[model samples]
Target: MPRTFDGATGPVAGRFAIVVSRYNENVTGKLLQGAIETLTQAGIADDDIDVAWVPGAWEIPLIAQRMAETGHYAAVLNLGAVIRGETTHDEHINRQVSLSLGELSLVTGVPMLFGVLTVNSLEQAIHRSGGNVGNKGMECAEAALQMVRLLAQLPE
Candidate 1:
């Protein structure tokens, strides 16, 4: 049988970085809360999780790249909200940020998660931040920890 290395689900034992977008503070704030709660519940210390606020979803990637390059954080979680507007600006922002974050993770060998909420309306954004659809921030934190553990198990 081919062997598969599965990441362990538990508290991450290293520093963590969270980049948040202030564009939709009401919504993003909820996501930030969820992410923090998840990390704390998983046994991560409050002091270990660092947070940075940027103007909007468009700015998450570069900050994440910088945080990843520092090698101080085990993983970086990006939380933002880009609600669609008349010009389809949200679509562009979402795609570019996702792509950039993906490339950063690949090149830096750091685990970076895109937790930004791309929705057609504020209602939909609210739904995912911590409402009906469930919280994506918590999921991001969990994913970060999982990836950290998985990387630790790999040959470095």
Candidate 2:
């Protein structure tokens, strides 16, 4: 038999930081709501979660990095919606934000959950935010919880 390490069960305790983009508030608002709800449901108190509102997706990484560097949070959730426009602007933002968040996670040794929605259309963004596609915010929050628990089981 082999021992398996899983985050399936455990008491998740720690403060969490959510860096949400104010752009596309129509979508980001929902994402923020879902993330907060999920965190609270998982035994995280409201005070345990801090939220920072950035101007847009491009600004998420900087704020998230600051929060993660403080070593005050067990995980950081970055939520936003980048709807593709006439140019490749969305592509650049998406790729760079994703890369930056990943790097911050590695450098800070904290779980950084990427919940940014890089969708082709507003309809698609709606679908993922809280529509039939499900809320990415909720998904990210769940991932954060799992990572927090999983990391605790690993050797440091």
Candidate 3:
């Protein structure tokens, strides 16, 4: 028989950090709200969660890296909204931020969730941030909690 490791759902025990972009306040704000609400509902105290706001999605990785390196947070959630514009700016931002956050998580052994929304329009962004599509922020928070528990079960 083969054994399997599963992330059990329950109240998580640890501190968390949310690095959000201030560029798209309309969408990112809701993301921050969802992440916080999810974390709190899962047993993380208000003070246990710290939020840092950056200028844009480009700055998320730096702040996220800093928070994760502190060894204070079990995971770091990166939230932002990069709506497609006239240029290819959104593409670059999304790729770089995603790569950087993923690499940072590997280097630090701490969960770094990519909750940024790289959507085509404001309507799409709205639909994802606590909208009909569902909140990516809440999803990120849940992933963070699961990662923390999953990692704990792995052998060092």
Instruction: Please list the C-alpha lDDT of all candidates, in the order they appear.
Output: 0.90, 0.96, 0.93
Candidate 3 per-residue lDDT, tens place, 15-91, comes to 99999999989999999999999999998999999999999999999999999999999999999999999999999
| Error of model 1, residue 3, in angstroms | 2.8
Clashing pairs in 1: none
Residue-wise C-alpha lDDT for candidate 2, range 1-156, written one tens digit per residue: 987889867899999999999999999999999999999999999999999999999999999999998989999999999999999999999999999999999999998899999999999999999999999999999999999999999877
RMSD of each: 1.2, 0.7, 0.9
Better of 1 and 3 by lDDT: 3
Predicted structure 1, TM vs. truth: 0.95
Off by over 4 Å in 1: none
lDDT, candidate 2, equals: 0.96
TM-score of every prediction relative to native: 0.95, 0.98, 0.97
**Can you give the lDDT of residue 25 in candidate 3?**
96
User: If ranked by lDDT, best first, what sequence of candidates would result?
Assistant: 2, 3, 1
Model 2 alpha-carbon drift over 4 Å, by segment: none
